[model samples]
Target: MKLAVVGGGSTYTPELIDGFARLRDTLPVEELVLVDPAAERLELVGGLARRIFARQGHGGRIVTTSDLDAGIEGADAVLLQLRVGGQAAREQDETWPLECGCVGQETTGAGGLAKALRTVPVVLDIAERVRRTNPGAWIIDFTNPVGIVTRALLEAGHKAVGLCNVAIGFQRKFAGMLGVAPVDVHLDHVGLNHLTWETGVRLGGPEDENVLPKLLAEHGDAVAADLRMPRDVLDRLGVVPSYYLRYYYAHDEVVREQRTKPSRAAEVAEMERELLKMYGDPELAEKPALLGKRGGAYYSEAAVDLAASLLGAGGSPYQVVNTYNKGTLPFLPDDAVIEVQAAVGKSGPHPLPVPSVDPLYAGLMANVTAYEDLALQAALHGGRDRVFRALLAHPLVGQYAYADALTDQLIAHNREHLAWA
Candidate 1:
């Protein structure tokens, strides 16, 4: 099967390439296309991709191009990982929200809404192009603000599924702590993208015994340390919240911490420079160790598994993915996209049934879902009012004064990306 990566020039591409090379048995790709408008970065990443494939003894041919239509034409699956405004825009996204005394994250709060607005239109255009070229192709989105982007794709009637490394990352972490293979550790992962919780850690299968209590009992401190949360919080909730929850559970503290540190985008920008320099080394046949620090850990594995299942190849039957709720959570609207464990196949993901959610988590999920709905509206039909309303609705930026100031800052920093601005 042929596959296309729209943002193949990204520093994250090597990790993905490494996965495609290592997991060829899972997703046997014949022609792999790297599509990016940044010709220089694309060339560097493309060269490394080919070397990784060859070093791994994979027989697939790798191609690179700037033409979106030509690159995705006739591909069985297309993965979206593009950043509409690059790291420069991301720096703004991660910094300006701090001016409002709020979290400056790329995937949530005011910054996330900015990313959603900038990303949705570009992704929609790409999806339309893909639809025109290969109507049967599955769009696997790995872009940030995935819930909003995937919702845009699905609403526009594209064949799509959103992938995040959070669930896989947790599975791997839990497996290492449990002395089991990652596949054997099934997470009862539920909630919206980036705002999820591991309600249960099952073994064998979804219906298998839940070992979450055992894990907490034994490794609560370690888990809490990893999440940067208090151990007692986990003990009280009896569930592991994704790291993103820190922005909510400790909003003021996180904002203070963020204010003290350089924006993640700035750090990533410097890292990308070093990574690109490393990618240029003809002798570098494998993904560099420094790339590990660049994040998106285990993304390759998740992408491979998702693509394989979507292509009707052998892969894990159940995996965590962002797709329509379809009543998996009674609290969420059926059309709202949610991240959860699902049985994935050629048709797409069908989220597994979840038990009644504790109001503690369900309330937050419902609140964010409503914010996301408004965020999507702002993204689709851009206006100062829509943007302000979305920011006002966010749990993190609920105050009108903060929302008003942040809305103007978001548009100001992202005027070039926002067509309406």
Candidate 2:
């Protein structure tokens, strides 16, 4: 199989290569292409990718290109990991929201909405080119604002499925806590991407043998600590919320904390410099330990499994993925993209039946779903009013004054990318 990574110049690519090398049997890649615009970073990342494959004794050849079409042409699958604007833009996304007293994040809050606007058009163009070259190829998107991006891909009629490491990360953690293999643990992970909850963690796949209560009883502090939420909140909610929720449940506190710390984008920018330096080294054969702190933990395994499953290279029947709601939540529109455990195979992911959602989670999910609708509207057909409306609908920026201020800041920061503005 030929597989293409659209943002292979990224420092994160080697970690993906590590997974591809280790799970070589699962994906059976014969030609791997790394596509990116940054030639210097591409060479560095490409060299390291080849070394990683060779060190793992894999036969697949690694190719690097700045030409998106050339890199993706005839590939069996294309993974979209591109950042439309690099960390410089992300720095702006992470910084200016503090001016409005809202959480500034790359994949949540106003920043995530900014990412969605910048991303959807670029991704659609690539998807169209991929379709022209390899109509049968599956597009596995690992982009931020995945819910919005995946929705755009599907709406534009691309053969695509959004992937993220968050679910796999949770499964790995829950398994470690339960003293079981990661494969043996199944999470009832549901909601939009980045805004999800682990309603259940089952020992058996797709079975209702929930051990979440046991986990909470024995490791409440640990679980709560991981989420950076108080143990009492978990006890009250009876389910684990994604760390992103902190921006909602403790908005003012998070904004205050963010104001005190250097932007994560700045930290990651520095980390990327160190990583690129390492990638340029001829002797470094394995993914560096420092890469772990850069985020997207377990991304490789998640990407490989999702890609393989979509291509009918079957293993586990159930994997958590971002796909249509299809009435899984009942409260949200069927077309809304949600991340949930699904039976993935050749036909694509069929979301497993979800338990009835509690009002607390469902209500917020519905609200966000509405906000995402407007967010995409603003993305597709750019207008200040639409952007303002989306921000107003967002639970994080519900007030008119904040929405007005955020809309102006978002547009100002993103004007270069927004053609209509």
Per lDDT, the best of the predicted structures is 1
lDDT of 2 by residue, 361-390 (tens): 999999999999999998999999999999
Candidate 1 structure, TM-score to reference: 0.99
- How does each model score on lDDT? 0.95, 0.92
Clashing pairs in 1: none
Top candidate when judged by TM-score against the true structure: 1
Model 2, runs deviating above 4 Å = none
Positional deviation of residue 191's Cα in model 1 after best superposition, in angstroms: 0.3
Model 1: lDDT of residue 346: 90
Please write out the lDDT profile of model 1 over residues 240-285, one tens digit for every residue: 9999999999999999999998989999999999999999999999
Error of 2 at 389 (Å): 0.7
RMSD of each: 0.6, 0.8
